[model samples]
Target chain A: MGNIFRFIARYHLFLLFAVFQSVALVLTFSNRSYHRSWFWNTTQEGTATILEAYTAAEEYVHLRKTNRALAEENARLRGLVEDSKYIGTVKRGGRKDTLQQYTYTAAHVINISFHKRNNYITIDRGFLHGIKPGQGVICPTGVVGVVNQVSRHYSSVIPLLHSRTRLSGSMSKTKHFGSVIWQGGNHRRAQMLDVPRQANIQLGDWVVSDTRSAMFPSGLRIGKVAAFSLDPESQSYVVDVRLSVDFASLQMVYVIDNLLKKEQVRLEESSAQEPE
Target chain B: MRHPLSALLWSIVALFFQVFVLGNVQLFGYLNPYLYPIIFILWPLSWNRATGLIVAFLMGFTIDFFEHSGGLQASAATLLFMIRPWIVRAVAPRSEMESMPLTLQAMGQPKFLTYTGMSLLIFHLWLFWWEAFDFFELFSILFRSILSAGVATVLVYTIQLFSLKSE
Candidate 1:
């Protein structure tokens, strides 16, 4: 034991360096998909508080633009209010399915990075505000990201700009679906892969959320086709999409609450587990 | 030579500056100038290596927390600290290194720039490659690292020069 102590004392600097390096690397690789370490991210209250304060101070310069966006969103919501829906028939006897499968909770983005190799967003809403991992985040214009981790008062979002982010997107005109992915260069652009070559894809054609995505509601706009070409290897069209949500200027967003997501996931899991 | 408390204060200032200011400034949509490595680069040569490594880890971790970049910067910074002594030895004259204080003034401007620039480039290469986590985009990683390291070197060297002038 004394010999071991002497050896350690001799090479203590290298040992310390190794220990610190390994810890940092482990933290890096382990939490690639999502933030596993709770206290070491922007979701932590102290970091979030600082970010929120900075955003608050920075909000003034963008107030006019943000207010304009809010006004447009409010107008759009006003058109869908209860009074706007006309009642054609009143049926008192039949059982009505009134449960909403999805709901929305508004939140403000406190910190965000669109120019990193792997980007993330932090919102003011958290577990206390009913935010949870796997929930979709969308702005008034289009899809933003998905919540990856949650703390008490803030949550981290794996934004669409991240390399690991893959969202189910479909052509609005033809309904053919593909996976949208960011290739780590431009913030306003993403690539939609696995699109069928035969699908009638045109420049400026809209891509929206597919029916199969549990995170997002159907018809939520993702982007528009900026360019496309056939991949000879995969025999599929790889489309460049111009993302609708301008990530640089994004602030306000809504966290999607898929009320029936648990039921749907359970059913799918059970069916998959059964023998084919 | 910097007092230990003063060094600590500079590290804190660099951390916050990197997190709040440089973190947001990405030139041409991709290259982010990481000025946090300045803290590690300017570490006092006479200080305990273990303490320097610890400080490097903590500073890197704090920057990661602010940027939400999982341990990417921390690992890169720690790796730089581990190799820093050798880098210093390689750049500076042995006699001067032993006798003189290892600051910009003692080393003169050109040698100091060489040391700082080389260290910054290697650190950024490690950081960007690890960030990519794959060798498929080797050119992209190299391009980003070189450009960003160039920018960071200028910024850090300018800051060092200003501090030297003030002192």
Candidate 2:
């Protein structure tokens, strides 16, 4: 009726604001999960392209640092090759056909955001390049993140700096396992929780990825314990770790292709299912 | 007020700067200066309320898309637009509100500071609070909100100073 129209006309701005706010809230809250809408994510073509261009322009400033990191990684890789050769020769008698467990694909980081609670990094490699979601990513110093979403030409990674990202980490010396999680304040530091007090944990003990994570290979470096305190309620020691990877200056990374990931996931899913 | 075309051009320039330059600048890890919301603050006061709200929404959504922040910026900026008129009526001079854009050049230094400061505070508090999105981290939210708002207000006033000087 005309009365309704009049009322609408009178408060149309408020109504419009409420409608827009509701839409924005839905987008904001719903996308907090691992599954995000394409429209607001960096994987969207327009935003990705713009970010790529900006990164490319700014890349020159960090060329020296990038070269240093790459050189260090090259040296580490060479050492690994030599070690593998030595192992092969030593175990020549029992060298049955060994199956490849993981493959590494080098990718360029096109864009990254670390200031947000759920930060993400975008790489140039994507589905076409054999990159898939849930794959692990790493750099020269340590583990980077896990692939969360992939398009044709790019993939988004959920970095360890994000609050939602949690990884199984263990002490290198004692093998005591804990959960590494970012507390949303600093990028360089993450908290490792659920470490029992009975473990002989020490300051500066290296923390590495545990064998339990299907996404990442065991023994990948995560960080070094910087501080620790006992939790009164859980009787577990909460430790702060200083991550090795400089997330701000990250440029190049290797995406891990776990060859047995599908098999492992299938087996786990089967075990999780109840009897029919 | 200037021509609508000019305002549109300025907005485009500001958007580009926000998306490309300022978006990348994160001081002290957590302090990100968001200068894009100035577009809403500087919008002509005489423009229609409904049109202004729509414009604010569009601007915010555009920035949110570029930031990949899932409409956080849009929600905060829209809230600012919703409360902007009341803020203007409260702080702005009567004559200035009737016939001028809400820029430092139009309003004197004191009024401009008050207006921009209040608007940016509300925008930033909404932004950081919604970003944290948890009541338990009320202290963290307040801390980050105030720090970021302080930095953003300084940047806004610096830009206003330069713009006024250029004019």
Candidate 3:
């Protein structure tokens, strides 16, 4: 007992290190997605909006140019709606849906964080303003992230820069599905894995969210395919996607709220419970 | 021996300067240099465990409140700080540590840099390691810790160098 006591007393620091490390690991694992620390969220967003407004005051003078750009965008969107009604890649798939499942509400980016391996962004709205978790966030160009956590007046989004954030996305032309994840290296480049090797991917092929994702509507823009190669061992293609929305330059984004997703999930759950 | 309280005052000043001032400065893009741990690094060697734990916890929790990672930074920082005495004893002799605060001036150049290097590496290595739970990408985590710590160490050294010159 004395020998044991002496050994422990002598090497107590290493023991403490191990114990502390284990506890910290447990804490990290349990909070895998991220615990929205409400203290800084409001301050960060509020401060950023103020700063942005102050800086963008000059840009505000060119309102006519902005108006023209928005009008052009609205017209292009109208064209897409018209074109999709008759001729889209998803001919039978989108039509089979009896009702609209998702809706996109546009909001300006209040704040953003990207240096950390698990980063998040804050938009200008929250639950009081009809925002919720699991909503898909996107810039006009491509997908940003799905909403992970929410506070009363603000919410944090798990951006594409985070290693934990993976989206079911696909090629815009070939319609190949793969999981898109941030490689934790660069903000602009994301990794798309689990793609079948048979798919002929080109350098500039467009990638978009697949129908598999409940939050994002099928075919919402993701990124351009930067690179792809076959994994010799597993025979799967690993595609590197250049994110369309540069998180560093995010100004405004639209949050797509899938109103019918919960109903759809519940229906699927109950149907799967048929005593099989 | 010079009054220990004055040396202790330097520790407090370091914490103050680090938290309220230098902590706000983001240099070299993502690197934020924090020297508050210098308080733990320089705790009077004669302090008892109860005082040590309390002081360490306060220092860590204060930063945690600012960083807003729930209780994570506090938990990790306090844990690292609590073990500092043992780290000092293990790495350096008690007689050398007796009345003096641990600093380059007290420990001399050779021992001081080595001690600080070891302590900082241990603290940061544990920090980023525990951050991800497991070795998701072990090499990358280690590289990040080393890179960030290297930059932080240089910043600390530069600050100390400049402050010493001013004094």
Candidate 4:
């Protein structure tokens, strides 16, 4: 008994090291996924408050640019409204009500990081603003990310710059679809994998979100194809696309609220649960 | 010897700088220069080992909290704290370490560089290793670790130089 006590007393530091190291390692590995505990995320009250205040201060510097973007978006929206009125007046038959498939909620980007393998953006809108996880986020130029987690007053989005983020993209001209994925180390570009070689893909072709996407509405702009090469093993084109959204300069964004998302998710989950 | 409160105050300053300032400075995509480990490196030699470890843990935890990095920084900093005493003993004689601040002025440039380089290397290696977390990209992990460590070492030295000049 005395010998055991001596051994433990002599190696107490080592034992303490082991205990602390294990705790840290566990936290590191467990929190890699988007579904990490809210307690450790930026949405935690103290961290969120600090980041929010910092972003509020920084927003002053970019106010003019943000106002310009907002003005341009408003002009485009007005043009669309005029075009819709012309179409309504020209129609001979009784008025056909257009279904609104998606709603957009404006939010302020409180904090963002594009340098990490899995980058995330925090927006000021949260559950209070009807924001939910798995909803898409976008700016005036193009798609930005998907909401990954939400707290009471803030939400974190997993942007396309993240290595783990994968979205379904389609060529605007040919409608050939591929998987757009970020291959860490670059913020301006992402790769569209599994595109067929004979799809007539061309340089500068526009890539947009496909109809099969659950997070984003079909036809939302993603990027332009910057480069392409055939994969020898898969015999498919690995296309590099230049993202349209300037992640670094992002300030104001819109979170998409898919009204039918719950129904779609339920249907998909049920189908997936069936045995082969 | 500096008072414990002063050490505590310096630690808070370093932690704030790391989270608010250095955390945002990413160069060439993967090189994040972490200068917070300097807090542990400069911890008083005469401080209790358990107290030092606790301080290291808290410092790391606070940084991680701000960065939303889970515990990557925390684990790396704690490991550095655990091995710091041995590293100090290995680099300097016992008599020279009595209440001496771990800085270039006190320990000479070469010895201080060696001590900082070794500890920072270990800290960065563990940090990027867990960050990548995959053996498949062995070369990338090694490159990131070395590059980041190099940048961080230079930055820490520059900070030390400026502080000495101010003094």
Best by TM-score: 1
User: lDDT tens digits, residues A119-210, model 4?
Assistant: 77888888899998889999988899888878778888889987568899999999988999987676888999999887899999999996
Cα deviation at B147, candidate 3, in Å, is 0.8
**TM-score for chain A, prediction 4:** 0.89
lDDT of 3 by residue, A18-56 (tens): 565455445455553334555455654554455345436
Q: For each candidate, report its DockQ versus the true two-chain complex.
A: 0.71, 0.65, 0.20, 0.58
Q: Among the candidates, what TM-score does chain A have in each?
A: 0.90, 0.89, 0.74, 0.89
lDDT of 2 by residue, A26-124 (tens): 877776452345543333666678778878878888899999989988887887774555453554567457789989999989888777666779898
Give one clash count per candidate, in the order shown.
0, 0, 0, 0
Extract clashing residue pairs from model 3. none
Superposed on all Cα atoms, the candidates' RMSDs to the truth, in angstroms, are: 2.7, 2.6, 6.2, 2.9
Instruction: List fnat per candidate, in order.
Output: 0.71, 0.63, 0.07, 0.53
Window of ten residues with lowest summed lDDT in model 3 chain B? B24-33
Model 1 lDDT tens row, B41-128: 8777777888888888888998878877678888899999989888889998576675555567878888888888888999999998
* Deviation (Å) of A182 in candidate 4: 1.8
Which residue pairs collide in model 4, if any? none
Residue A236 error for model 1, in Å? Answer: 0.3
User: Model 3 Cα RMSD, Å?
Assistant: 6.2
Give the candidate order by descending lDDT.
1, 4, 2, 3
Error of 1 at A105 (Å): 0.3
Ranking by DockQ: 1, 2, 4, 3
* Residue A168 shift from truth in candidate 2, angstroms: 1.7
